[model samples]
Target chain A: MSTALAPARTGSDERLTGFAGEPLDQRRYRRMRFIRRFEETLLQLFEEGALNGTTHACIGQEADAVAVIEHLAEGDHIFSNHRCHGHYLAHSGDALGLLAEIMGKEAGVCRGMGGSQHICAPGFKSNGVQGGIVPNAAGIALANQLSGNDAVSVVFIGDGTLGEGVVYETLNMAALWKLPLLVVCEDNRWAQSTPIAANLAGDMAARFAAFGVPVREVDSTDVEELSAIAGEEVGLVRAGAGPRVLLIHTYRLCHHSKSDDERPEREIADRWLVEPLLVHGQRLDEADRRRIDDEVETALGEVVATARALP
Target chain B: MIFAKELGDTLRGALTDDPRVVLLGEDIADPYGGAFKVTRGLSTAFPQRVRTTPISEGAIAGVSAGLALAGYRPIAEVMFGDFLTLMFDQVVNHIAKYQAMYAGQATCPVVVRAATGGHRGYGPTHSQSLEKHFLGVPHLRVVAASLFHDPREVFSDFLGRDEPVLYVEHKLLYPQHLTLPVNGRIGDLLATSEGGPLPTVRLSAVPVEDCTVSVLAYGYQAMLAAKVIERLAMEEEIFAELLVPAQIAPMDWAPVERSVAVTGRLVTVEEGADGWSWGTEAASVISRRLFGRLRRPVDVVASEATVIPSSKTKEASILVGSAQIEAAIRAAAR
Candidate 1:
């Protein structure tokens, strides 16, 4: 796993990269791009006073969702945090339900009850409580292991969630019980308004390693590499190698929620240069990228239209 | 059968009856058999399903929620009811809200069993009736074990249900015999039961007529109230009805209503510290429903609002015992 914070090489040089001997699918790019546009559209709706409550968009962290979800099997479950739109879309592909849910429509996934932070679809669940879902994910893995099913449980948490103590308690149990759990810690370097340095003490990787759970760290914004690492980690967990962690050191491109970005403007601009979409989008042909973007725009437009028209 | 043995047998029956039933707790496995021995010999009978978890109440609850979501009926033990505060977020924020928040996309058929109540001298933290804190939490059922209510029926019913339940087992009642109502009578009190899943039993004197006051309680306090009512009828010639609702949360007001309607006065008894308690809610609800019919304001007999001490005499004074219930009933009837 690469530890360098510099942007990975993109464009034609990375066009043919694959994980597990399978060529990189264009659908990955399409999914990542769709999540990006969907959340960006949510922000637009938030500004227009069309949405209720708050939303934590995974604008720059789309690669993590798209990549990690690719390795999940049908029975495998994904437990996500507040910033769960990307994970929900990548896992269940129910954008309309999610969109309608955020709009508080009756046809929403959770019948509009979950809203933005809480979403529940089959094999996919998300909650806004930081680090609270870690044990839940471990529990699913425990069930699968007990039932003799090879299903893996994957949970996505932000760097800020590490401040919660339950996460460590879960890690202790997951490692001790040999539960097939893959913990994807998306270290976006910021916990709401506070930076990682201010919120977290000691090392993130060492935290998991202390419980004897293996850690696979990635620092690049490239979806291909992230998918590769996620695949290996998920495969190992499924193969009964106990619980593992994939600490993706990335940056949140958007505000924490709605216009709460207190970071330096120069820092935001610097992160934008190496955003996941740009890195992965550069690898796709111009026409292919344009086609995917157009499809995402149309799909998102239809979702918004349908959600707004809901009674 | 003893209360703990009946609970253990009920759990064993549940484990034998369903493969989906899994037990999670600290020291609940054979040998250790939980702090109260309610789960004794379960892990030995069903080793695969009976899992002894680390002392992590939050994880025990979260894991149980996860299992329930995956189509398993999990019974998680929180060792002591006071430690339920540790699992508060998981129960209130996650387990309780999953079904409603998910809009029926999920159902958590998890039963968290915590041994509750004082009189054991475990001091401030261990000996507490914290079920009051969890009452009225949406989608969460709070059921207490009583000598009148069979543990087998309760666990079996929980296995068939989808909602989460906080099963409160009073510590003092563990060794006591389960003297169930025979021919609608337990000892000198005639038991008229109402409701289902969790029944509310109305116990009165045998020739049951013209009860002066209705004493409402649950769990061990209900037993204490039974003793008080029987003694009141036998010694003082003061007849009072004891209304014990096995299920506290989403309380079945039917029995209370019936008893209060006849007696025209009500007194709620509980072991929890005073203020914002189950008794308070019962009093308020019953008072509202039977406003004109009641003869006087409903009385709430609960523990003194203070930390429970380890000293037996101090704990006795701080806790609600038979004396308090008898005194309150005498006053309410007067």
Candidate 2:
């Protein structure tokens, strides 16, 4: 498992200390790197035929998973769909267990029952199908409401997932019930091969607004800005304001999967120019950047060795 | 005939007693009391937990799965049995598979209550019995209660369990008063009638020694089967033992196997269509597990494979009757 944003038991750094109740930007930075490294490792394992099934790598969508999830408390549940490696790594931080699951090992989080597509643990659950997790996530929110707990439920869906009818059905119910839910839709331009523009009709804002849910969308590639907006929105839901939707306009640099290379070369080339890591790193001082880079490198090296040594 | 209101009272009792039990379905709320009135006064009694969802069958059942995972035992009622098809994917894929698939990481303690069977003139969509569609799903408990059995106990029992259960009810069985022996498999009713709890009620047609065949049944068919047993005792003096399995999936086969073991003949009855019904499963169990003890081939009484027509005559022709049970028993005995 990658200890990216580990529990407070770890010793604090002297130069850039993240003490109790402090904003952990450095920690989230490492978490994103961990997800990036984990997905890269998954690709290599897939190439070597070490993994059983094909994985929908969230390589470029790391910022969307981290920025939103970073605001949630430990007890808050996250329901995930196909492209969920980043979400699992962000929430559970169990990269090795995820790798073990990809390899079909009994020691995996779901006991080798659920692989990359179907990963679930304590406080986190996922399924393979798009639009499948949203309804259940609403139920989890209802559970929180019934139990009188302030905990919120978040579901990670994509722009293309709106093509599924159940998402609208679930949205209507969630809004009607006044359940505490945060619906995060990562719009990465393309939906596998087909673009979201071709299938989805109607104004996105009006669709959710009519359901009585507050909708917010960020077109920026900056992770910190995304995090700040999400934190405020999460606070609103936590304060009994009902469900909210965070529509993130991000881009995926990697192919949808290992087999996917049908995307236009020019389109892929343009997207790489404004990818997250380089742009996001320029904000921090050179010393802080190097520190995070060194920590992430050491963690990735150890993560690879631990994943390979398991079986 | 035992009326179905007693069953309603039983469900009401569970809600009143336990805080975790919540009744959800179409028109289950005040003034409506459910389409069949099975959940009458439940919303009035427990308003917070009980709710009338917006006819979204898939989401209603899907939400129940979430509610169960979150700790409350959600009783999701699909007004008619046919609508359960809309949510069958959630029932079969998520609710049933969650506990087993996630290795206990998730549990769906949901009891899906539906009115199933074809005696009413409601047509193919509204009146068909589709329990067979979900008969063999793993980790899902299939229970169909008749008037003779304790509907209260059935709801309370499955409500307390950790896994998901599909509890099927027949519309006609509701207005009828239930009648069955307290204890024993087939003929041991007199012995078990003395004392103790009856989880697996096997009302005897006659004493074990006098019994000619063991009739295995559940749901509404239990009444038809009981009628046949009564007539067989009076007209032919050919006694047959009846086995009403309260729990269908992972069936309580001990008393059933014992009944067939003594009687040397076995017959299974169900309201679902003939192909791949619970009766087929019972017949298979008898042939494979108790073949040596059987004196003849096992018989199954089930509705024929066809759409349930709206006309009264057409409906009667398709559904199994006491006459069918009687014939099956006579053939098994011979």
Candidate 3:
């Protein structure tokens, strides 16, 4: 029931300390770190040309995926956009299938037909499409409404996706029908090298609020904070409070994809401002941070070894 | 008897029978009912299951696909077949490719119902038999019901299957009623007659059992072919069996091949423009496989290769009818 927007604490160390005091378990932190490492390895693979097609690594924006996924039940659904590796991993999608999909192998989630752009997990009934999954998530939420179930549908979109007409259309319908849906905009300053100022005009949170839907903004780097806010909002939706929007402020650390090499100073400055992993890691003590880093490296190393072993 | 009313009753019965079934479309509710009245009284009968949606065709199809993925058998209506173009992406890319693209991991068991064909004078925008647009999708089923009984039956079958279905209904034939034989139950239609007991019929010098002419006629065209056969019976003593293919894509070819074997000739009749239509594809398939059994070349009776004319006289002239089918049948017979 708390509608108070937590003020953005300055300094990575202070933010991390604040998050550590919150209720995130070590296992969840380890998982978030594992996603960051896995994404870093994926970027390396893409650099070596081992993986085909475009890869949108959620390198810096790990907290958004981790936090939002923590609020979802196993039966609830997650509809992800193209930049979905973190979301997919956080939602319990298979690592081997994710790697195989990136490699365009038959073992991939989409059977190599969709490459990394459209991987889906049948078990969870959760899937990822480029920009097409925006309206699709609303449709799924509508289904949950018709079924009269408390299952909440979450749609993860980047700042760039707000430009799409379908996304707004979906948001309007979700609000109009008072459907149980959570629209999480991972506002990672840059949408494929384009800054939010250059692309999006006007305030994003206010845009949804104007449509009569409650809107909230949070720091995407703090997993514990993000999880708390997301969990409360999801609960409200389940209680028939209608659709809500969470504009999570995050950063995309890497270049848009392997193809883009434009690492301008402005981009680097923007990345440093909201470096999600660095900011989240800085909060823990030196020993705890080192332990988390080692665990993440080992886990990612096993995944890389397994992916390489595939024939 | 399985008349149009019975068809609606059967659909209502099936909806009430299954918890997974849900219906959505324009004017599908009670009072005004559907435009064709096929879903009459369904909304009130099953208030929770049957829903009337806004006139957003793309959203209708997309929602159905999503619901199907979420384990619901959603039967969505597009009001008219011509409006299907608006949801082409949802139907062809999303619903059709779900199973194939996902490597059989997921299935979309959604059924899309649309009233197709000309004769309502709704002109080009409203009237079109465009099921051919969905012909070769890997994991989709295209079922057109010419008779009233088959709609409920085919719909029930589609609900049980794990593939998406484009269930096309002809607007012109909705009023043309056909009576079910005595002792025939609604359950009989629900059963997929795949490779069932073959009908014994005499064909040109040979006593054929199960032949496949791929007599690819759907909706009103199928009824027209049957009428043509009736007229042929009166004019000549020749008994040319008509194969009305209720299921087109992922076609149940066993019955069709059985019908074609004895006849050794394939004749297709369709109301759509001839080029690349279902009739054309059926002709090609028959000619290729049944070439050895065939005594003569395959013949196709379809509408002229032009847009549907607006004038009644021009429309009648351009549209292929029983006479053309009769001529085609005779040509293939010889």
Clashing pairs in 2: B1-B176, B1-B177, B2-B176, B2-B177, B2-B178, B3-B176, B3-B177, B4-B174, B147-B178
lDDT of 1 by residue, B35-81 (tens): 88888888988888998988888888888888888888889998889
Between the candidate structures 2 and 3, which one is better when assessed by TM-score? 2
- Candidate 3 lDDT at B233 equals 48
Give the runs in model 1 whose Cα sits over 4 Å from its true position: A1-25, B206-208
Candidate order, TM-score descending: 1, 2, 3
Question: What interface RMSD does each of the candidate structures achieve?
Answer: 0.9, 1.2, 2.4
The local lDDT score (0 to 100) that residue A104 gets in candidate 2 is: 83
Candidate 3: misplaced stretches above 4 Å? A1-29, A52-54, A104-115, A122-132, A160-169, A187-212, A217-225, A249-251, A261-265, B1-3, B179-215, B237-239, B292-296, B330-334
What's the alpha carbon RMSD for model 1? 4.6
Can you give the lDDT of residue B239 in candidate 1?
A: 91
The lDDT of model 3 is 0.69
Off by over 4 Å in 2: A1-25, B1-3, B180-198
Q: After superposition, how far is residue B3 of candidate 1 from its true place, in Å?
A: 0.8
lDDT (C-alpha, whole model) for all candidates = 0.86, 0.78, 0.69
Ranking by lDDT: 1, 2, 3
lDDT tens digits by residue: candidate 3, A131-209: 3565566667777888888888888888887776546655665676787888888887777767788989998888788
- Tell me the docking grade of candidate 2: medium
| Tens digit of per-residue lDDT, candidate 2, span B1-334 | 2455887787788877877777778888988888888777878878878888887887888788888888888888889998888888788878888887787888889899888887889989998789888878998988887755666656767766797888888888878776644433333233222212225556654676789898888878887887778777778877888777767776767888887889988888887888777888888887899867788888888888888889999888988877788888888877
